[model samples]
Target: MTMKIKKILLTTDFSDYAHYALTYAVEFADKFKAEIGLLHVIEPIIAPTDFTWESYDIAELEKKSREYTQESLDKIIREKIPDKIKATPIIRYGRSFEEIIRCAKEEEFDIIIMSTHGLTGISHILFGSTAEKVVRKSPVPVLTVRDPEHKFEML
Candidate 1:
């Protein structure tokens, strides 16, 4: 059966693994002639110190952080994505997997392509795997890419 993949959501953590996955995402997009949605989810940093008018301070911090993030996103599009394929940068603040799933559903993307950290043992138990969660929860198909060159070895 032929699948109509008009839109593809590409997620990244700016890691080498994610950048490696971009190669696959780009190949898929080119083959399907689909537009690419580049998604980067940033979790808010919670400070331990208590402060007056925390919201204001947090808002200011968020603004500056987002500005740099948007530029990073734009740079990725300009440097990595080809001229033939259409790409857009999307930034969302929240849990990575949740935002990825939410964006895929809200934007009606055909699939989500991302890199897996392949976390194991303690790291896996403590942090869990974002790609795994997205695969299980996403409303659309998920393509998880692993960078064969990078491996996490336990000390």
Candidate 2:
């Protein structure tokens, strides 16, 4: 069966693993002639003590985070992706997996492409896996790309 991919959602944590996934997302977007929406989710900061900062201070922090995230997204588009590809940077503040799923559903993305950290065993148990959670909960098809460091035989 043929699938129509007009919109592609690419999620990143600004990590090397995520950078590797971006390459695949770009290739798919090129093949399908799709518009790419690059997403970065910043976990909401919670004050440790009862004495909380003013709303203005919180707003400033969020603004800075958005600016930094946008810069990073722009750098990837300018340096890595070709100029012809239609790409937009999206910044959302919340839990990574939740925000990713919400964006994909709300925006009606055709598919989601993201990198997995490839954590396993004790580490996986302790930290859990964002990719795994996203894959399970995502409304659309999710393509989980593994880091290049985890080599596998083609056979």
Candidate 3:
């Protein structure tokens, strides 16, 4: 039996590294004749509890940030994605991995395609890989693409 994919979730962090996944996602979508849901998750800013964070206008900042992100998402679809392929712009506010999984489940996407930055050491410890977390927990299939520029060297 052949697999049938109708909808695809393409996750991006708006980075050069994340752009790599677009190629793979497009190929898959083209093969499956699927629509692409371009998703971008905005992580909430964590302010220090003791630093008088209330003085800052975080709500306004977040609103502007979301607006900016939406524009960027649309731009990507308009420029990178093919006209023949249907694409939707999706933006979520919360943890990156959590939002991705939740959106995929809620939208009933056939598969999730995203780029992995291959974080290591302290950087990895501080901000864990979102792609890795999604792969571990997502009930749906996840396809992760690594940065083409990064090469694993023998230690």
Judged by lDDT relative to the true structure, which candidate is superior, 2 or 3?
A: 3
Error of 3 at 47 (Å): 2.6
Full-model lDDT for every candidate:
0.88, 0.87, 0.89
Which tens-of-lDDT digit does each residue in 38-143 have in candidate 3?
9988878877887688788888889898999999999999999999999999999898889999999999999999888632347566777887899999979999
Off by over 4 Å in 1: 50-56, 118-124, 150-155
Model 2, 2-114: lDDT tens digits are 99999999988888888999999999999999989999898887765555554347778878988998999999888887888999989888878899999999999999999
Q: What lDDT does model 2 reach? A: 0.87
Better of 1 and 3 by lDDT: 3
| 113 Cα displacement, candidate 3 (Å) | 0.4
TM-score per model over all chains: 0.86, 0.86, 0.90
* Candidate closest to the true structure, highest lDDT: 3
Report how far residue 91 has shifted in candidate 1, in Å: 0.7
Q: How many Å off is the CA of 72 in candidate 1? A: 0.6
Clashes of each: 0, 0, 0
